[model samples]
Target: MRIFGKFLMGLMLVLAVACSRTPERGGYRPAPGPGANPQLGDSAPHSWDGRGPYGQQVHGIDVSRWQGDIDWDRVRGAGISFAFIKATEGADHYDPSFQRYWRETAAARIPRGAYHYFYFCRSGAEQAAWFIRQVPREIGSLPPVIDLEWTNSQTCPYRPPAQDIKRQASIFMDIVGRYYGQRPIIYTTVDFYRDNRLGDMQAEFWLRSVANHPSVPYPGQRWAFWQYTGTGIVPGIRGDTDLNAFAGTRADWVRWLQARLTR
Candidate 1:
């Protein structure tokens, strides 16, 4: 009897040790570390202080786990007017740097917003709730953003139906809208927008079209912000950083920040 009990104890220890091992990184989870902001096609830095690749007036940068440590003062000094920091995704997963960056951005007095990289498998309401829980109901934080882009992962493949997509979007938008008392900005790519028709809804858009500005394919399409390039070089950052120029002048940015009424 004693031998059997000892054997069971050894077996349990082995299982406990195995349970703590890290899973192999793949799609849906990029390895952590600093990332270089690669330069986009023919997209070189041009005028700043209120202009974009498409000549729009609003400028902002979206951050994720890939982008490593940043110096707040350097970013503010580099003419960055606003930023969207990654907040959360599924119920169990949240960005580690979200609150840190959000507080830093707000402390710098930069108009800052929070975003969630939606998982294809997560329901809209779940995503919304998770994000709400992750981002504190802080008075100074800017409006929240929803990043709806393609999922290039095996963990949660792209299998959601159109109706499901719409339902999910509605659930998330409705919750966030009610939470913030205004519609949250929708951040997406050209392909995702065309495939999902995400623009059918009424929220402001932060479009990503690294190739062409918002004018060519989306003619007459007014956008609140544009992400023209992934690769950017900003001083004070350890490596290449994504740089965004506001669509308008510094004054225009201030006006948007003032009007948000975040409280």
Candidate 2:
């Protein structure tokens, strides 16, 4: 019995060593396991006013050609920690401002990412390929975002069935994920989320809620970013811009970025 107990202890030690040696990405630390959702504390008030309920939350903005030329230096100085610059749209319509925004934002020392506006009219593989071609693979950048939501444009108003939508989304994300070494984030609206049941997908979510908190629409789901308002007024930006909040504190945001780097 004593010999058997000693053998069990030795086996456990071997397993412990194996677990401790888990690989990391380029020596970066990994994220905490599930239930490690950002320490965002309690839910805050839901309002359409400019002021956010969470005090001193890490706020950022997403911009494209509509925002005209951006002074990224002034933006960074205004306390913006990050930005999601538009990269591509559909399979062929690359956002004209993508390259300039990407270059200027990085030069300003802002941790930025690129997002592709998905179109139902084009094949997922084609869209993914186009995005990959346009956005350069930069180290230490945020994971590429796949913005999937309904559009009212007359050009392509068709919404594919839920299954087809899911399949195409999966294809696009898989392609981008394999290329970037990190899972892509899905940005969707409330109606789209409900129609497609996107919460089941095994990827991070960037939900859009203009009035209510995300919890009202995306209950019991994990989200990394939230687009709380579309009429946000930022200093360097001329017109209204889409503003987003990282789901955690400043420390949590740093850890989240580190986790993506490790991924």
Candidate 3:
């Protein structure tokens, strides 16, 4: 009886130590360190390899009026680190929801920036001025983005020469960058980027490659952001919205923001 009692106490002690060392199911897990595997959570997740955008630590979204009535609080709470709201298109067309998104995102404490969609018919200078007039010079804003892409508008089918496109983009970036005190990011699709030889440009790139990794499509190109999907189902957004990932870890994201966010 004494030996049996002693054995029972030893068993209880071992079990207690094992239970304490083991993690509870659904309990807190430490955030991944730099170069560590990131936790993946996307509604329409891709079968991404270890090097894909899912591996990126910082994720964000770009929104236009099409997203409609966003719940900025939910978006911020959903682990979205930043946003780029469409402010202007061409020289005259302003996105109707730009102001609301800008205000709400600031209230939610999400780092926000504005983007101007380049209109083929409009001069770069004219479009840049329009964007400047529309987007406020707010402190702590992310650097402005110039969205460069080919549009299928019947009103503006003019595809300028590569040299001309480069020149116009340079003009827009120069003006917008000077105004914002940060170099503008150029957002472009694979075709548009190749056609315009945008790789030669002296600017950070936000490359779009939903089907494959940006490295696969944009070989040898160093990118700041990768637009990985256009049919993303984010919690705060209605319908499909574009999803993007920063090119570094959480710490790297903070450092980049410190260096590039508008003062």
Candidate 4:
């Protein structure tokens, strides 16, 4: 009986240690070793050469109708701290899933924002007005995002001059800013950013750099969010989705939300 009691005590101690190491749902977990390829405990299939999205304390996804139906509860449980959903494009086109995604993310208690995909063929004021009509002016929502990138559309392939692009973007952002009472974030690709000199703009940035860290591609440009991968696989998402990381610690994320979230 004495030997059996000692064996049971040892087993219990082992189980306790194991349980302590298990990550809680929606809790932050440190990344694996620097040399580790890809991400050890993440669902990403592609490998990142440097400190990747997993290294960040706060991770999130940006989605559109292409993602199909999502299980928001599972996404939140899988450690998605926030979401940016596609709301509008051009002057008349609205994403069919915008309302559903907005509603579900809120129900899941995840901070959610809307993004407008800029159409070069349309005037910025028109596009901004379209976005304002579609997205609600919620108090706790994340600030709006304006996606600026070159498109491969055969019908609307007109690339405006750099100065023109900047002017239009400013108009859109300024109008949206007034409506939301928060400065908007500009989401841009590397080529678009460099070509348009977006760094000169007085707005926060969400940069896309999938090959390497944003610092490698963007150089000295400060960024609020870095989209590290577009082929990321998360728990609730059916197919690939864009994954992004906040450029701060967990405490910084809390502070940012307090300061930057819609009033």
Candidate 5:
């Protein structure tokens, strides 16, 4: 939610100077979505190397404004337990439909949460400020998440050095904490953790580990969610869509979800 360019120039300089000594805590790397793995094309069928046909438990999708013409009923029919919808973006950019869908899902009674794409180029406080403006004040929903990963898009291109990336993430998390009022989950990869020492943060992590089932690359560490694949097929959803299986069970889903009453 932090806007880019708001405080990036100053923070960029700070991260550049202080990144060599950050320590490694522990973490997870989510694999790919059920749709298109940036590494793989859209032609790849939605599937995973782990559990046969993925887990029969809680399932869901995280969509950006890009995925169009969605049939959410099919998604509901497919037994999706929850969905983390893309809401606010760095300081300025927001999906046009973020509010619309936020209300839509609220009406549909889908288990949902909002996410902010982290910008390593900015300070955490600024990013958090941007996110707070976007997210409505409400309670009992899924915890806010800080989506931190390597993204080289045009609007916010101009990558920082790798160590600086870690510093930026540290600041981003600090900022997100200020507003969200919870230690938000960090979504990132193994290499990012290793390179940036993200393990040091030890915040609740949503890992992208693309292997069979949920296995920790770094032993003796606990991870919150493991993203198994970008390609996934679920019953009721049209064609094949990307899917993610949580590390726990249906009961876990019920526990984590915001307590909302729906008829």
Candidate 6:
């Protein structure tokens, strides 16, 4: 009986050791890629002095799992005209909360779009296929977005030359555009804008300029959406959220969506 008891204890110890060695899934880890501002995109909320200059324009927000579970109804009530939700990143990772958020936003009557974080480490074609696989090509949805930014992590340390980066971006946009039947928007930062000379691309631009208007930083450049502040306070979002404004008025917003949907 003593020998049997000893064998049972040994079996339990081995099981415990095996469990300890298994890797658990990570929760809420933001992707290392373009279109997120590391300084402003942290998990915690940020403080802002006042709503920035684009208050008069049609406003919106962009979000991912990092924002935690969101109340989409409250967000719509906050006078948010639109939203861009993170759908996929790289070649394999899909945002864990994407399906829930997508359904909730649709039910809440807020126009929502899907965006893929472009990874410098992978081919743009592969990343686009990954995004296409995850995000359904739904009618009446806002156009897709390609977010490009420098990765601060060791996972993707190489910043290809300007031409190579542009080439990859073009390939990604082309494939995604073909699948969605609408041109994609390019979300980029000031430094990345200049580094890649993105003005040369045919895709509409979504520029991130927290301190100044995009026009100031991107002189003589036209932009479809300007992300004016990352520390925006909206009713539905628990923490500080990134805020954006369309370049045109409410009528323009309707017209824009109609054109995309019917085109």
lDDT of each residue in 1-263, candidate 4, tens digit only? 45534533453343234223435533446556432222223345457675666667678899999999999877766667789999999999999999999999878778889999999998999999999999999867899999999999887999999999999989999999999999899999999999888889999999999878898878899999998888777788887889888999766876687677776
Q: Arrange candidates by lDDT, highest first: which order?
A: 4, 3, 2, 6, 1, 5
Q: Model 3: per-residue lDDT, tens digit, 197-257?
A: 8898999999999878888989999999999888776777878889898898665876687
Alpha-carbon RMSD to native, per candidate: 17.2, 12.4, 13.8, 10.8, 14.4, 17.8
User: Model 5 scores what on Cα lDDT?
Assistant: 0.57
- Cα lDDT of candidate 3 equals 0.79
Number of the predicted model whose lDDT against the real structure is largest:
4
lDDT of each: 0.63, 0.74, 0.79, 0.82, 0.57, 0.74
- How high a TM-score does candidate 5 get? 0.70
Deviation in Å, model 2, residue 113 alpha carbon = 0.5
Encode model 6's per-residue lDDT on 18-129: one tens digit a residue.
Answer: 2233122211112233212212232433333343443433567999998887877666554566799999988999999898889998787677899998888899899999
Candidate 6, residue 7: Cα displacement in angstroms equals 66
Which 10 residues in a row give candidate 3 its minimum summed lDDT?
21-30
lDDT of 1 at 238: 60
Model 4 regions more than 4 Å off: 1-26, 33-46
Error of 5 at 187 (Å): 0.9
What digit string (tens of lDDT, one per residue) describes model 5 on residues 1-263?
23323333332333223222221211111233442211112235435554532433445676666555565644544445456778876767777767876776555445566788877556666777887788774443466778877677776776677667666666766766655556577777766656666677758777776654434464454666666556555433334455655656554544444122110
Compute the lDDT for candidate 2.
Answer: 0.74
TM-score of each: 0.75, 0.79, 0.84, 0.87, 0.70, 0.79
Name the best candidate (by TM-score): 4
Candidate 4 backbone collisions, by pair: none
Number of clashing pairs per prediction, in order: 10, 0, 0, 0, 29, 2
Preferred candidate (lDDT higher): 5 or 6: 6
Error of 3 at 150 (Å): 0.8
Model with the higher TM-score, candidate 1 or 4: 4
